[model samples]
Target chain A: EPEVTQTPSHQVTQMGQEVILRCVPISNHLYFYWYRQILGQKVEFLVSFYNNEISEKSEIFDDQFSVERPDGSNFTLKIRSTKLEDSAMYFCASSELLAGSGELFFGEGSRLTVL
Target chain B: GQQVMQIPQYQHVQEGEDFTTYCNSSTTLSNIQWYKQRPGGHPVFLIQLVKSGEVKKQKRLTFQFGEAKKNSSLHITATQTTDVGTYFCAGRVSSSNTGKLIFGQGTTLQVKP
Candidate 1:
């Protein structure tokens, strides 16, 4: 089956440094999303992107976070300055239809470690 | 903000025993989805429930949505050792147009052989 693919299976960055996580969603999917999970915690929604722009974002998605669809296939999330609390597993997901209408396919996730 | 809560943070049972996980939402949901994640793995979609009082079954697993659309459950019969994983319930609020899902803390199941 076609699946979402992410780069940098694991990234270790220092505090106050910029970090970028990249994802290539399924070929035909329209909606894309970014979610994060702290160790042993529930999955938390960060932002949703459609039509090359962010459709909705949660409070956790603050000024330091930004998402971009640089090309037809690449979706990227950038953090301006990483903090210790930003350490978590970030997952990239995509769906063929609207959020409530179809199931999401998630990538294996990129583990970010900030020190 | 929407919240999804799951009960019995952890469950341990014998291979032949049954297992069930319950999920409750703070707000009525337009739809609810279940996902399973093995240790150190990403969340994989299992099933989705849309209508109130809806029931769906897959082989040894049964899923139900409450009549009020605020609660749901997953039941597995004669669980096997392969059933060990964390099950999560995610809900989309009826009032929101975005596809943001509020996920529960999840129920971690450990089946002993």
Candidate 2:
């Protein structure tokens, strides 16, 4: 079965440095999303993207965070300056446009560790 | 935004015993989805429940959506060691523009052989 895939399974960056997490959602999926889970915490929604534009975002998705669908297959989340609290497992998910059945498939996730 | 709550943060069951997890949402949901994440792994889609009071079964697993569309349950019969993982219930909020998922805290299941 086709699945969502993310690059850089694990990343380590300096506290003030920038980091970009990349994801390639299923080819036919139309809606994409980014979620994060802090250690021992619930999964939090960060942002959702559709039609190459942002649909919704949470408070955690502040100015420092940005998402782009630069190409048909690539969805990226960039953090301008990483903070220690921003270190977590970032997951990328996608769903088909089918109404009433918006099942999302998630990637293995990129573990971001900022020191 | 709607929030999903799962009961029993953790569950320990014998290999051949039955296991069930319950999920409740603060508001009505368009649909409820179930996911599983193994230790040190990513979340994998298990099933999605739509329609009020709908019940679906897949092999040894059974899923139910509450009549009010605000709750769901996943039951696994004859649990095996492979069933040890964290189960999450995600609710789909119907917005005019887009649909987003609100995930529950999840219930970690430990199956002892």
Candidate 3:
């Protein structure tokens, strides 16, 4: 089956550095999302994208964070200035239908470590 | 703001034992979805419960949604070592179609052979 794929399974960067996490959501899926999970913490929503624009975002998705679908297949999340608290496993997900339909498929995740 | 909490942060059981995890949401949910993450792996979709008092089973695993749509549970009967993973219950409000998920803290299960 097709699945979401993320690049750079592990990323290490110094504080204040810019970092871009890339993902390729499953083809044919219209809805894409980003979620983060701190070590031993709940998964937190970051942002949701549809129709080439952000549909919703969480408070955690602040000015420093941005997402874009550069093309038909690649979805990217960029942090302008990374903070230590930004270290976590970032997951990319996609759903064939609506979010409430509940069949979101998640990527393996990119482990970001900001020092 | 909405929050989803799960009970028993960790569970260790012998192979063939039964296991269960409970999830509660601070607010009403239009639907609830379950995911399982194996050691050092990503979360994989398991099932979704949409109706109040809904119950669905997949072999040894059973899932139920609360009558008030504020709680959910995952029960695994005769669990094997492969069942050792973290289970998360994610809640979603139908009012929002952005596909964002409010996930529970998750219950990590360890099954010993």
TM-scores for all candidates? 0.99, 0.95, 0.97
Give candidate 3 misplaced runs (Cα > 4 Å): none
Question: Which pairs clash (backbone N, Cα, C closer than 3 Å) in model 3?
Answer: none
lDDT tens digits by residue: candidate 3, A1-115:
8989999899999999999999999899999999999987788899999999999999999999999999789999999999999999999999998776858899999999998
Docking class of 1: high
Off by over 4 Å in 2: A98-100
Per-prediction DockQ scores?
A: 0.86, 0.60, 0.81
Ranking by TM-score: 1, 3, 2
Candidate 1 chain A minimal-lDDT segment of 10 residues:
A96-105
By lDDT: ranked, best first: 1, 3, 2
Tell me each candidate's RMSD, in Å, in order: 0.6, 1.4, 0.9
Superior by TM-score: candidate 2 or candidate 3: 3
Those runs of model 1 whose alpha carbons end farther than 4 Å from true positions after fitting are none
- Native contact fraction per model: 0.78, 0.56, 0.80
Per-model interface RMSD values are 0.7, 2.0, 1.0
TM-score of each candidate's B chain against the true B chain:
0.98, 0.96, 0.96
Candidate 2 lDDT over B7-35, as tens digits, reads 88999998999999999998988888899
The lDDT of model 1 is: 0.95
Chain A superposition TM-score, candidate 3? 0.98
